[model samples]
Target: MNRRIGILISGRGSNMMALVERADGYDVALVASDKPDAPGLAWAKSRGIATFALSPKGIGKAGYEAQIDAALREAGVEIIALAGYMRLLSDDFVARWRGRIVNIHPSLLPRYKGLDTHARAIAAGDAVAGCSVHVVTEELDGGAVLGQAEVPIEPGDTPEILAARVLAAEHALYPRVLKEFVANERPNPA
Candidate 1:
């Protein structure tokens, strides 16, 4: 069966767009966001993909996560992909969907576990940078890694430059990983 995917985004959703354009054996069942004005919603709509918005502005974290869970179940989504989704999901939610949700992070995880990774790496004078595709876990960015693609941190490189390079890898890695996941027919440890 074609993998049914639901993507959650909070911004431009470049990775989501990449999946939509490249996914030949999968169905993008829904594209959802917490921000109604998120550019990605409009982008998804333009491509005739279903879109949803649930604002967490007033609703607390638990309430918001509850809604997300309901939404995913209602849509019959088999795989959940987080693409630039800024909010950290609740532990209960992550556990409920463990082995089914995946996220693309801007750093080769276990190295730069949280935000500002590019800057932190550059400031620390790291020689290389990359992105990771990993299974989602309760602990932020703490999951078994599926795959990663690295780029050299050139001399005098700014965070912005490094970020762009890493994002390019992200755009390529996520879909490839998803394809492998579907082909293997297993809940990969990552």
Candidate 2:
């Protein structure tokens, strides 16, 4: 049986769209977002995918996470994919999902752990930069990498230019890695 995956997004969810379009060996069970007005939610809804969106602004982190957790469980989601999800997950949330959460980072990882990855790579005079799909942990983008795709940084590459290329790589990398990850995970007990 295909594993059910829930995707979390904070914005356009271009990665989410890619996953949905190219899904194999797994099913996208739900698309949830911290930004209620996120464009991704609408796209998911239009495609007949179950979606839940709530802003965490006033509910506090704990409450917000609880609601998200409840929704995922309710949807029978076995894997959580962070696709352009900008919010930092609380340690509690990470611990709750543990090995089942995965995220795609814009950098090669173990290099640029936080934001501005493209800019940092350019400033450091790096020749190549790419994307990584890794298991999500408490530390920001600090998980064991499952796979990576390298994109050469051209001489005139600005962060925006580099970012666009990396995003394309991410779209291709995330689905394949997530499929392998789901296949490797131990099945839940009946």
Candidate 3:
């Protein structure tokens, strides 16, 4: 049987859509979001995938994550994929999932760890900007990189332009890496 993967998103979830579209050897068990109105939720619902959404504004992180954890477990999610999930995950939450959580960051990684990666790369006069698919560790984006896709930075390229290209790379890279990761990480196979 295919592994059950859960995706967390905070916005349009372009990466999540890519994973859904190109899914192989795994099933999207759930699509949960911190932003209740995130467009991705609607898309998942339309596809008949289970979805859960709750804003952390009022309940605080602990309570919010508790609910999300329950929802994920209920849906039998074996893998957690963070796609455009804006909020920083608490250490406790990360501990619960550990190596089971993976993320797609819009940078080659070990170079740009946080946001504004495209602009940072351009500002640094880098020749290429790309995306990375890696394990989600307690330290931000400081996980073992499973894969990367490089997009050459053309002259006069703005962050917006570079971001679009990098995003396309992410769409292509994430699903393939996730498939391999699931195949390799089966310590507790059912």
Candidate 4:
């Protein structure tokens, strides 16, 4: 049987959309968002996928994640994919999911760990920039990279332009990596 997956997104969730489109043998059990109005939640709902949308607003991180945990568990989610999820998960939450959580980062990770990756790369005058798919750990974007897709930096390219290119790469790279990840991450069936 295919694993039941839950996707967490904060914004438009292009990567989540990519996963939904290519879910050949997997189940999208749920798509949850920290922002109640995240456009992606509606898209998931339209596809008949169960969704949970809430705002972290005044709630502390622990409280917010507790709600998320309940939702994912209630749905019997087997894997958690973070796609454009802006909030930072607490260490305890990260530990609980350890190898079961995967995230996609805009930059090639370990290089641009925080926000504004495209602009950071452009400011540093890097010739190439890309995205990374990795396991989610306690540290931000510090997990082992499973795959990367490089986009050449064109001359006079602004962050917006570079971001567009990188986003395209992410849409493609994330799905491919996620498929393989699920295939290999299983325990041996006896």
The C-alpha TM-scores of every prediction are 0.94, 0.98, 0.98, 0.96
User: Tens digit of lDDT per residue, candidate 3, span 2-97?
Assistant: 899999999998999999999988999999999999999999999999999999988999999999999999999999999999999999999998
Question: How many clashes does the backbone of model 1 have?
Answer: 0
Tens digit per residue, CA lDDT, model 4, 1-190 = 7878899999988999999998855789999999999999989999999999878789878888999999998998878999999988999988777788999999987899989999999999999999999999988898999999999999999999999999999999988898888887873221
Candidate 2: regions farther than 4 A off: none
Question: Could you tell me which 10 consecutive residues in candidate 3 have the lowest summed lDDT?
Answer: 181-190
TM-score (C-alpha) between model 3 and the true structure:
0.98
76-172: candidate 1 lDDT, tens digit per residue = 7888999999989888888888788889999978898889999988988888989999989988898889999998999989999899999998999
- Candidate 1 positional error at 167, Å: 0.8
User: What is the per-residue lDDT of model 2 for residues 1-190, given as tens digits with 9 covering 90 to 100?
Assistant: 9999999999999999999998998899999999999999999999999999999999999999999999999999988999999999999989889889999999998999999999999999999999999999999899899999999999999999999999999999998998899989976521
> Which ten residues in a row are the worst by lDDT in model 1?
181-190
Return model 4's CA RMSD, one decimal: 2.1
Global Cα lDDT for candidate 4: 0.90
| Winner by TM-score between candidate 4 and candidate 2 | 2
lDDT of 4 at 42: 88
Go through the candidates in order and give the clash count of each.
Answer: 0, 0, 0, 0
The lDDT for every candidate, in the order shown, is 0.88, 0.94, 0.93, 0.90
